[model samples]
Target: METTAPIVDRWGGGTCPFDAGWKKVMMWSFIITDGLLFAGFLGGYGYARTMATVWPDQSTVFTLPFIAAMTFVLISSSATMASAVWSAQHGQRAVAVRYVWLTLVGAVLFLGMQAYEWTHLIEAGATLSGNPWGDALFGAYFFVTTGFHGSHVLIGAIVLLVLGINLARGRSTTENVEMAGLYWHFVDLVWVFIFTCFYLL
Candidate 1:
């Protein structure tokens, strides 16, 4: 009788098919799902815009210079987040902590500017139901999309604060800093899309 060979389990418990850490994999999964959520929101906004008899003129409804400043701050935060990750990877914990704090400051500034913008719009009669702008759906879509993105920024800010403290205390790892960078970059990318499709187009 011929002896049978035992088969090897290539994907056993110790294996990672993607060759990435569990934290990175989980963060990527979250990013993908969250990206799809934004895509759906933008798609609906586009459709509603085309169907509406009157969509607000972006120039008339938005302060381009102010929006540009907000964009600059968020993009700067992405850079600082990247620096933090790089510093952590290089074992420069003190520098990493400083970068994390800088990124957090950028987030706070962006949120403050956004709040000021929202207050100005609301005072001008912009709301979920209607607005002084051309189309009513315009107000609904604008608030919903931007608000959702702002909520993500807020969450990112909180995470950054925790990560900063942990880094300073020697409780955080390079991988943890990298994951936070991934999240911050995703938020920045999403804002670019929103700025283009919603504000520019």
Candidate 2:
């Protein structure tokens, strides 16, 4: 009797071909979904602003200098994240670690500025239930958009901390750094949209 060769199952195999690049693909998928959500929020905010009898003047409602500084901090963090990725790609572990630390510092400063802004706004009588600008939409847009961005910044900080620890322990390789870079870049890219839509225009 001749024995037949055993056939391997693609799905049950130790390494499935589809699973090899699934993580990166999933990240991109998630980013697209999140982009859509943000776009929806922004569209609603725009519509409400246009319809309001007394749309809030951003210049009067927001402290330009403070927000400008915060924006600078966030942009600086993105720069550091880019540096970190570059260093990792070139196999400079120490340089990558240092840049990551700088990035975390910038993240912390940005969060602090945001906290200060929120408190200042609340003290000035701007709340989800009330609007200082006479149009309720102002408060609603402020809370929803900034709150969402704040949450992203918080998550980015946590991820940065984890990546920093791993790098210090020699556990994170170049590929791991690159993976973290994807997340860092995404956060930065989202901020660009937020700044443009909410602050600039």
RMSD (Å) per prediction: 3.7, 5.9
Could you give candidate 1's per-residue lDDT for residues 19-100 as a string of tens digits? 8999999999999999999999999998998898988888988899999999999999999999999998998999999999
| CA lDDT of each prediction against the hidden true structure | 0.92, 0.84
Give per-residue CA lDDT, model 2, range 48-93, as digits (tens): 8788788777788888888889888988889999999999889888
Estimate the lDDT of model 1: 0.92
Q: Residue 169: error of model 1 in Å?
A: 0.7
Off by over 4 Å in 2: 1-20
RMSD (Cα, Å) of model 2: 5.9
- Candidate 1 TM-score, true structure as reference: 0.93
